[model samples]
Target chain A: MAVINNKNGLRIEKADITLGFIPLTDCAPLVIAHEKGYFRNEGLNVTLSREASWAGIRDKVGLGILDGAQMLASIPVASRLGIGGPKIDMISAMVLDLNGNAITVNNDLYEHLYAIDPRSEFSPLIAAQALQCVIEENKRSKRPKLRFGVVYPCSTQSYELRYWLASAGIDPDRDIEIVVIPPPKMVTAMTDGDIHGFCVGEPWNTLAVQQQLGHVVATKYQLWNNSPEKVFAVSESWANENPVTHQAILRALLKACIWLDKKENRKTTAKMISQAPYIALPEETVALSLQGLSLKHHGQLPEKVEDFHVFHRYSANFPWLNHAEWFISQMYRWGQLTTPINIEETVAAVYKPALFRIAAAAIGLESPSIDRKTEGNLHEKNMLMKSQHIGPNQFLDGQVISVGGIIKYLEQQSLSKADIPALRLINIQKEA
Target chain B: MKVLLIDIDDTRANKLEPILAWTGIELIKLNNHNTDIYQLVGEMHPEIILVDTNSPNRDTLEHLAQLNKASPRTVIKLGNARSESINRLAADAGISIYAIDNIPTKLLQSLIDITLSYFYSIEHLRSEIQSLKPEIDARQVLNNAKKFITETYGLTEEQATDLLSKNANRQGRTITEVARQLVETGSFI
Candidate 1:
């Protein structure tokens, strides 16, 4: 690529570009980057296109129609593994945000669970156990399987929903039905009785609770503290051809994320993204969660969960290899991917920590020195007060996965269809 | 063979239905956004599905193809030779194609070619009419300007044309713009 230095003194390969984003609150980084002049600060002209669906975004990026996009964190990995959609080589150097999705059950389902066990309102585990009882009763009555909606087939929401369902011995595939619905239409689908519950990002979950149509059963934060939700991904070939341009975009997004993490700026961020060209929702609905209020129940004050949407704090922007492995492990556990491949090699190709380090360093920010870390090891004490570099990483089931222990982690998950021996044999061969 | 046309509006679907009728291809048009796509695809078992590239229903169709391995999957791996045409199919026609594995590649290619030509023809006529209207309107304005100049100033048609051209060149504007302004205001700025 020819390097042309702009007036800003950055050697940008391609300055005029178009990016795609779905109308979710986590699309904040890209929107803020464009709205706040961060992209322009880096001598780049960017257009943010509002996409109708994740599939459309994926295909456009694959076909080079879009320069890059805000994608579900699992999409790049799934795209590489050829799991749910077309096999396209995609990569991400930075994670946009973490832990902004929640699972909501319709009012009737919530009432049933509450009737079975009152503690279900306070505890996600208790709610799942109660749901087990409700499922049993529905089975005895021979009613059709309750349908649950997710944003995409190979999405973080899908895996989180399955992880929550499998917590109480409910087979997500056999015990209930799972369908894909776009985020914008989620609440309307629930109102029309097309789905009994759904797992999606805000402000759909907040909108559902506000309309009194559903109650939040569990949140992605509660399921896995500070898990990755959305990422900034581009085609691998695009990254190779425009390395400087990619880094420029990443640096701009990092600046946007740093600005988003500040408490005072969040209200304005919410109001800005709620305009007609972006999310196009009411400011209050979008502001509730962006301002760190988890509105899980109607007719009650929203709980203050300050880390509800972590844009930059706690090394959140770093694209850890272990996170990519977690997504791959989920794909195997759910039988979405039946083949066994080298997990380390695949993640190394898809999640470029080396690139993230470069971008983070350019802005004089501190990133994690290592690319992999043990999950489910941090407690509240380790991550409290915002003094630590990394935040609490705990799983609801309290399963700890070592750096190279993804196969072992997959072996422990219930309702998993993974072939451990096969996986182990292939990975060991690759290691040798 | 069963072919499902999803989210194609009435006008386009009407044009495609007849072209596909005589080829032994049964076309099923689904434009409703609220339909249970998974259930419909499962029962109908369409060998080929064509959906709008930007349709909100595309995600559900993707999920359906993923959940059922035997179902009609997206034609993603049409080899390096056909990828350019696939890009054209998406960028030009705004369509995404899905078909079962056993479908012949030649048949798929012909279907894509047919759809692309159909869209191009319609687009061609639409643009032609759009381009012609402004020219016709410009001619009417120029004639009106010339008649007013000849009747008011006692100048011949050639003199009026020369006068308008001189003013258009002096103002660095198109003749149509100067004529429209003259006809509207009875004088040029």
Candidate 2:
């Protein structure tokens, strides 16, 4: 497919296209790109469709029903590797945002956690230990296992929830029950006692806190600073067929990310996404993350945490292969990926950093030269370092889990019995 | 002996009972107004599950997927508008059949039998692919690819096979190459 140099002097193959996005605050970039005319400015006509779930987005994009989508960071990788469902080779040219998810628990659980440890640190370990105590008491009393909800099986929410719980010695699979619930229904599920807590993106977390049904226990920033969240993903075949259009989309989204990073424009963005056609949540609820204000917790004053929702800064939009590796490790650790996989090959195939570089260069936005980096390392000077452990990659257990370390951890952790059937299926397929 | 039929709107549910009466199969009507359909499916392990809705939303699809995972049962979904993505998801989630457009009362028994037979054949093919050992033959791969294409595009088997060969010829590649690509990528041209 040759790129046509149009009258506008822009190299584009397809202008009119449809993009899918779930109704979440992090979908701001896609909405702003459409509503704020960034897409039009880039000589593209983009229609944003609100999908009900991540599976819908994945399937629609894989089947070419939608050109692309705002997807969970792990989705493209999982889809490509056939982890959760069928294998659909998806590529992520740009990341949508970073660190907007938080874990929230019902008021009763929050009260129990507070009674165990009332420190203001919001340490994942302390909260997990308290949960352990609760689990033990429930076991003594013959209560049902606590159920936790996540948006999708192969999402960052599930990984973050598993990571937090695993670090505290709680077996996510054996000790508790984890279920998949849509983001909009998280609050109602928690109120109905269907789920004890949930890990999801805003403004559901904010809404839960606002409704006094639950309190924030840990933000993704605390778990892993500047963690990659959602991405603009498309099928690999689609990207190859319409290279120019793909680059144009990346360019438009880059401009939107830059515009969103501006401090003064955040309030406007929150308002814009709060409209009916977009996120359709209250303006105040959507604005909380953008404002970077303190979040409410049960039996405690609001806690201040900056960088709650990062759109562009810290090279957030760059699709790093290292992040993909981390997700792959999590998938293996959680038994989602039953068999061994080539981590580097799978990650490189899914994350198109070269396309991101081209789009960023077109807009004169400086992007990282390297595609891989060490995650969980937080520091001031080398925040965007590509390699050479520039900062602290510590988890709650004081262990800095790197790619190699995670592989070892997976080896040490036995695969749960529940995953045996899936593994057997894979084994059968491999034998054939 | 038993079939579970769930429809939130009583219109389609009422019409389904008369259609299944001739089969002598005991039909269990479930009030889909209840939100916890997944839990209900677990409680009542029916041989077959049927759902009718005006439009199948993500929630309904997700619940169906959950039911498929928790209990391996044949599921058939009937909706008004045809959605390629929904059909693909149904296939991935192990749903036997997803029929769009209004149901013709006269065709109910035949459709049910077709769905069950298709599901059994697919299951048999999966096991055959497994037992073949070490190398899945081209014919098996082609059969699976054709099945995927027919499901995704709502095409007949012959049409899907013709499309695969035509695309392969256009690309100057063999049918095996094209069929393998389709099976691996889960996509069709």
Candidate 3:
């Protein structure tokens, strides 16, 4: 029964908070939050319901099977906008991590890029352009579009890579393609050259760079500089009914994020995330991943590290409305939003910034990037929105442009017989 | 039509049915040979697809990934987000984050709305393609007719179209049928 003022009383006291999470290194927050008495601190019992795919999480959440989850920042935006599937209203409460993802090109392509340019230097923007040039040149000789991999469609990596390439003037739809590959299989998949590169989080990016199979072309930090990565999202009703419980959970998580940011706690926190039940890779793998953040042994550009994944930096925890606006812009730019959106109201409704502020105040936490309106231009080369800014134009950079209605723009250039970019899979395997 | 459970029965499964009912979600079950996961994906193309995390099926995640592209806007369901094993599988499949249930119905709808809002573009893209097929086909036929006129009348392609348009007006019939009649019957009908 729906909760009324004082008569029906909410069942949240006994309600289950079935959280879902993917197994990537970034999933550590959910694990740490739950494992470290975070959920209990909030007088709540949350079942850490691990899931199969971004699809699975969405479905379970839609049908009320699971409550909320650690989701791709775009997932909430996509779900609410209903671009990938049926419109499912969702939102991100907290910005989990940042700058964990990277673009890893396969060895053959890496060598091929070098062979063509002969200057295997450290310019991701130029390399991206060079890669596009190679794809275009090869197109004349019947070279099929090379496949690149991202974790999911509703992932920042997908948009980032697309945005990155588009800024360099490469059409993601027609030029180098992106396919979704799980992090575990990313390296092996890259080896086959079935996928030329992949954009993924943590150990995987470190894994690729360490193996020398590929190099990091760009970090997500370069894409949007502290863009929301992932979040522990639940249904809005759940939070509304269980206000104190929600605050408690946030308080617990507040501790985790604080611990994660500490220089002394990094080793222990990394160890915890790399646990057998967690990211279960070798300690060395986890160490390498953590080391890659600061160390430059793996060809990772140190310059990108300054604005890398700041766990508690710059209001990362604050689910600001402007941040919502930024994502909405991205949704429109990427053809994720089909209809006209009430971006302002939608942002207010989707983002629980007020709740976040309350939690931040309770926890006595200070967020970096005090102003969410700072319009920051991404370092990657996504110029389709040359004059489009994904977020509010509040950053110091005048280069920021609005991503308003870029989908309509891409559609105008790429309308189908049906007047929309209707994508069909290249392979329709027979039911064998 | 009831929403298919897409999995076998158990306590959790049985409880799921009523819970969904309470939440105003009426889904059915199709755990039999009639379970043409592919054909159903093509025809029925359910709004939501629920798959078990433990099922030994050929990476249903992969299948759903492909289906996501084909089905256009259908959602594929999994149990929870904490299932890292399954989450990895789903991520690799190109599915969007439609729903992640662990909170309450409000959060679920928030996620759903997010999914719906996000999917609108791609789904609209699908509808756009679906709606314009006939027009495109007609245009193609019109082009073919224009080409035929270019060869027969020894006129340029542009001149042939202009000639066809003028003649079709004189015939008092549709240009497409007139163009077809001219090409096939070798005379204007």
Candidate 4:
């Protein structure tokens, strides 16, 4: 039921909307759309709400107090599966940004890991292995389990933190206590000795390093190259009702993402998002990662790691169904989601690739013809030139999840609690 | 039954304290934002916890509800069973409710209705006072304008009122507007 304005040649179901966002650097898409008049250009009045927590954003969006929000990539899927929270039918049509999170450990823990293996600072896997040795020694001496922090129970940071630990044979649940801390409180918690390490989105990691409170042990990009991070999500009911307005928002975000990805605009973005109403951190702290510099250690020069915070390149905005499957796989592996479900059908319901295609096509961009693709197969050499439909998708442990092979991938994961046979039965039933 | 209120204003909490106390509901108010929510919730084990919807501590509480059975989980279904009431609770009251499992929806609804009416009454009085403020100010302006008219033109109070009414009727404006104009500008065109 879209009512068109003949004068403007655009029809918006709901013109005035309030969208929620945490004060993170990746919230640039929503902020840019609002600040740069992209929303106004589309004849939409969008008020960007600076939310306090992911749970606040999730609940507000669920209750329709928010029209939509920038959310963790796993939220819509997790909410749909009723894992880690109440069941809420949510969907995401666009990925906001990719690989903006990092795992940081307190200076004392970092020193312990570094003493075991000097290369821990350079390699995520080696850092995990070194941390494993430290964990073993602590257990032998009857020390308490190391506590880690994440932004949410079902966030991508939680999954990434677990995946990094499991790479070195450390069980996240059994070996360490993972606590949920608000992103802004993460550095304070680390300083107060409450959490030894945390995996969160920037610029908290940057702030911790600047304060000499922590050292970056592993980054999300190193865990899985260019993996999906934050996404623009809305409740399924809201999308169904405001189809036209949703499309308009998607268009505005896409344009903003394109403008953000250019190398020259990175500094301006850092400065813009660092304002009082946005991330509110110093521009230099937010500028490091946005400018492709990965600061892993204190009293050292930051490493040049391009793609540290990918906004648009490499078909990053496409809501890949396989990416949704990966989050579900982690949920199952961690025992956060136990009930068997049709993996393909579930991912399709949560990630709207068809809607993404419509939005992409209207902007004269080419989306991948297929909804799902094999992850962790493409490397840097293969993606040297500009690619319209693919990007670097390699994992830290060299694990590749071929299309429709999520169950097989989960079966091979270390410390997995997934019942592969039951999952297969559900998938087979769906196909039949 | 124990209920914890986090970040509610002191005056409102004080008003709510005795009202809830009469029903044997012990209310513990947590005003410090720096308090460790997990440790407090673990120790207090309150059946129902009320907090602002936008509080930064809500996420840590959500994590606690996910990991610990003793902690109160969010009351999502209350918003679902009767959305209108829940919307008013969130939008007007700006509060979110979390309660342990098996708390009946009817009980929660009644609690919400009580809280809503309490806030509504306070809000009702505040708004009533708010609406009356302009009238009081206008009366002052009218009196000052009458005095100005009497002192400058040697007109009677009735004559001043008649002149203001005439100007208001001619300009199709409120008498207050004409009176304010004369009081501020010392002239009514």
Q: Candidate 3: lDDT over CA atoms? A: 0.59
List runs of model 2 lying over 4 Å from the truth.
A1-11, A298-301, A380-394, A401-432, B1-34, B45-189
Locate the minimum summed-lDDT window of 10 residues in model 1 chain A.
A1-10
Could you arrange the candidates by lDDT from highest to lowest? 1, 4, 2, 3
Candidate 1 iRMSD in angstroms: 1.0
Which docking class does model 4 fall in? Answer: medium
B1-189: candidate 4 lDDT, tens digit per residue: 999998877776776776688778988999997788888988998999988888888888889988987788776667456367677777767788889877878888888778778778877999999999998999999999999999999999999999999999999999999999999999897
Candidate number achieving the greatest TM-score relative to the actual structure: 4
Instruction: Tell me how far the alpha carbon of residue A371 in candidate 4 is from the true structure, in angstroms, after superposition.
Output: 0.3
Q: Point out the higher-scoring one by lDDT: 1 or 3.
A: 1
Q: Candidate 4: give its CA RMSD in angstroms.
A: 5.6
Q: Which residue runs of candidate 4 sit more than 4 Å off their true CA positions?
A: A1-8, A381-388, A429-432, B79-82, B125-189
| lDDT by residue for model 1 (A1-432), tens | 344575447688798889999999999999999999999888789999999999889988998889999999999999988777888899999999999999999999999999999998879999999999999999999999999999999999999999999999999999999999999999999999999999999999999999999999898999999999999999999999999899999999999999999999999999999999999999999999999999999998998988899999888999999999999999999999888898889999999999999888888988899999999998766755665367888998989988888888898999899989999988863211
Ranked by lDDT, the better of candidates 2 and 4 is 4
Candidate 3 lDDT, B21-56, residue by residue in tens: 655666666556224354555565454444453332
- For model 2, the docking class works out as incorrect
lDDT of 4 at B74: 74
- Top DockQ hit: 4
Q: What is candidate 1's lDDT per residue for B82-107, written digit by digit as tens?
A: 37667788777677888987888888
Give all candidates' CA lDDT scores: 0.91, 0.73, 0.59, 0.89
